[model samples]
Target: MTLAAPTPTVPLNGDFWHTPLYTRTVDDGPAVNDALHALVLDRTRTAPTSTVGVRNADKTSSDLLRWEHPAIDHLRGWITDAAWALNDHVGAGRTPSGQDAEMIAEAWAVVYRPDGIHQLHSHHDAAWSGVYYVSTGHMQEGTGLLQFVDPRPSAAAREPDRTPLYTIRPEPGLLVAFPAWLRHWVTPYQGDAERVVVAFNVGFSRS
Candidate 1:
C-alpha cells in the first residue's frame, strides 16, 4: 500500500506570536470584567497592599488559581490548546521537556491603568508564560503593548547599537505565548481607558 502524504504545517516563530492570537469574543466580556473588578476590589479592601509589584498604578497581580473560577479554567484550556498547536508546528513531533511547556502552572490577572507598565524581566521558576488580553478599551496610545527583547543581542555585533525587540499591541480576547526565559515588559499605557490582561506561568508535573 502507498503511504499518504503528510499534512503541511505552518512555521512557529515570533511573527506568529500575535498573527493567530487565540481569541474568544463572548458577549459577556463586560460582565466578566465586572466580576473581575469586584474580586479585585474585595481583595484590596482588607489587605490594601495584597496587590504587589511595581508598574501597578491602579494594577494588581493575583496568585494563579487553576480551580478557583470557571473563567480561569476556560482561559487555561485555551492556552493548553494553543500551546499544543504551537509545539506541534515548531517541534515537528518532538515533545517539550522544559517545565514551561508542561502546562502545570497557575493563572493570574493584571488589572490596571493608562500609565501602568511592567519593567523588563523574566519568569525564572516557571516553564512557559502567556498573556490573555481581557479588554482593550478604545484608545490609540499605549494600551500596554507586550514587548519582548531578543535573547541574543550580542550576536548582532554589526549593529551593536540596535537591540532587537518585538511588540504586540493589546487586543481584546488575544492570547500570547512565549518561553518563560524570554525577557519581556509592558509599555506604559497612555490611552484614556484601562487595560486588563490575565497572565499565566506553567510548570512541569509527572501526572
Candidate 2:
C-alpha cells in the first residue's frame, strides 16, 4: 500500500505582541529652533548637573518641567498633543470607557558634548516617555544615536534582522515617544557640536 503525503490547507494567522513608538517633525522648524536658542541654550551654560549618566562632564539641566522657562512654556501644546496621541494608542485595545490616562510627568534638557554619552536606562514610575531634539547640529554617523533595546524575552533567539536593539539619529525639531519601561541609551557623540535634547516622562492620572 502506497501512503499519500498529507496536504495542509488551513491558512496560518498571526498576531504581533509588538511595541509602539511615535515620531513627529514639527512643521514650524525655524520657530522651534529659534526658541531653543533664545531660551534653552544659555541656561545649560551655568546649570550643568553632575548627575546620573555615563559621563560626568555631560551637561544635563535640572528638571525644567517645573520651571517657568519660555521654552518649557512653549512646549505645553506639543506635550498635550503627544499625550493625547499616546492615550489614543493605549486606548485602542480597550473599550472607549476604559481608555488610559496620561499626562506629562516631568521634563529636562540634556547637552552631550563631544564624546559624551548617556548610559542604558529606563524611565521608571511613569507610563510614557519622550524626547524632543532641540538642536542636533551636523548629522553624521556615530554622533550620538538614541537607541532602544528589545523588551521581548525571545530577543536572544531571534534572527539577525530581529536584532535586539535599534537606534535613531537625532535631527533638529524632531520628537519621539515610547513606553516608559523600555530600555534606551545614547551613543557617545563624536561631532564637534553639542547634541541637545529635551527628555520628558509621562504619568497616568485620573481625569
Candidate 3:
C-alpha cells in the first residue's frame, strides 16, 4: 500500500545547532583576584622570564594551583565545583557515577604586560581546560581577546557575527571553561597595566 502523505513541519526557530560554554561571575571574586594578583606578581619577581606553551607572557609555575595560599584555596574549591558542573552539562544532566572521579590538575597564573600574547595551543594531556580572568588592564577594544578556533572543520563559513573563531572580551571575575582539546589563544595585551589570569586544566586521576 502507498504511504500517506508526510506531515509538514517547521522548526521552532531558525537556529539549528548549539555549543556548550560554561561561565560564571564569581562571588567575592574581586577580593580573591586582588590577593592572587599580588601573590603571583610577587612570585614572578624571582623569575620574570620563565614561561610555557607559546606564550609571550610571564607566569608563575604551572604548578601554581598546587601552592598554598588563601586565594588559591578558594579557587581550588571553585574549580572542583565548576568541573563537576561541566560534567553535568556534558552528560545532559544525567552524570555517570565515575564522572565525579578525583581530578588530577595543573594550573598557573599568567601576567601579560604590554605586547604580551599567547599562540594557539591545546592541552593534549587533560580532559578539561579553563581560564579565570583577574584583570583586563587599561586597554581599548580588540586587545587581549581570548579566541577559540572552531572545532568543526567540515562546517562552511558562517555569518560575520558567527565567525569561525569564538572570542571573549575578558572582564574581572569572569571564568570560562571548555574541553581541553579545543585550540585557543590570546590576542596581544596592548595595555600598559598588566593583564592577569589564572589558567588551568583537569583530568580524572588515572590511578
Highest lDDT: which candidate?
3
- Per-residue lDDT tens digits for candidate 2, residues 1-207, read 011111221121211237777777777765766776556667766665654776722445546666665666556555555655655555531335764333436777777777778899998877778888888767567668889888887667656566677778888887888888999998877775766778887675444
Badly placed stretches (over 4 Å) of model 3 are 1-18, 47-49, 54-56, 92-99, 157-162
Best by TM-score: 3
lDDT tens string, model 3, 1-207? 011111221111111125556677787898998998888888888755467753567877777776778998777766665566665556521225643355667788888988889888988777778899988887668989999887776565544456688778899898887778888999887886888899988776555
- Using Cα atoms with residue i matched to residue i, what is each candidate's TM-score against the true structure? 0.69, 0.78, 0.82
**Whole-model lDDT for model 3 versus the true structure?**
0.73
How much does candidate 1 score in TM-score? Answer: 0.69
Of models 1 and 2, which has the larger TM-score?
2
The digit string of per-residue lDDT tens for model 1 on 72-131 reads 555555556555555554452233553333345566666666677777888766656778
Please give the lDDT score for candidate 2: 0.66
State how far residue 40 of model 2 sits from its true place (Å): 2.6
Let me know the TM-score candidate 2 reaches against the reference structure: 0.78
lDDT of 1 at 72: 57
Q: List per-candidate RMSD values in Å.
A: 7.5, 13.0, 11.1
